[model samples]
Target: MKYFAVFLPMLNEEKSKQYRGDHIAYLEEMDKKGKVYAKGRFTDGAGGLVIYIAETFPEVEELVKQDPYVKIGAREYEIHEWDMKVTEN
Candidate 1:
């Protein structure tokens, strides 16, 4: 699986709040499907981040489009491909 870091910077906090529950539900659903690796929000209310695992970046992009945040235009996302390094020295 490939990893992607989704950087979400809040665009409309009010709108985000309105759809927060749906957003969490979406993530939880993805987690059940083994799509989400990790997720969290910024304490400062900037936005949130989600680490996703998928076969390809386009696949991840498709998943992101389903997020409430994206669907409602509450935030903007920047997707970065991540390469995890393991140390077994």
Candidate 2:
């Protein structure tokens, strides 16, 4: 399985706060299920980014579609399929 990074460019601060808990819960579930390798929010606090390892693009897309932000239409995402060229550990 290859890794892909999904970038979410969010807009409404109020809406994001409203859905924050649910979003975190969802990410936790995904991580537990081994769908998400790692995830985090931007330092500037504008949006978020998540890295997922999956079998195919469709699977990645399906997982991303489950995000609360996407469901509520509070944010939009750009998905980039990545090839891991190097790792220290």
RMSD list, candidates in order = 1.5, 1.4
Winner by lDDT: 1
Q: List, residue by residue over 1-89, the lDDT tens digit for candidate 2.
A: 88999998887777889999999999999999999988999989879999998999999999999999888877788899988677779
Ten-residue segment with the worst summed lDDT in candidate 2?
Answer: 79-88
Please give, for residues 1-89, the per-residue lDDT of candidate 1 as tens digits.
Answer: 99999998999999999999999999999999999989999999999999999999899999999999998999999999999787998
Q: Which stretches of candidate 1 lie above 4 Å from their native place?
A: 86-89
Compute the lDDT for candidate 2.
0.89
What overall lDDT goes with each candidate model? 0.95, 0.89
TM-scores of the candidates are 0.94, 0.91
Best by TM-score: 1
Regions of candidate 2 where Cα sits further than 4 Å from its true position: none
Provide the clashing-pair count of each candidate structure. Answer: 0, 0
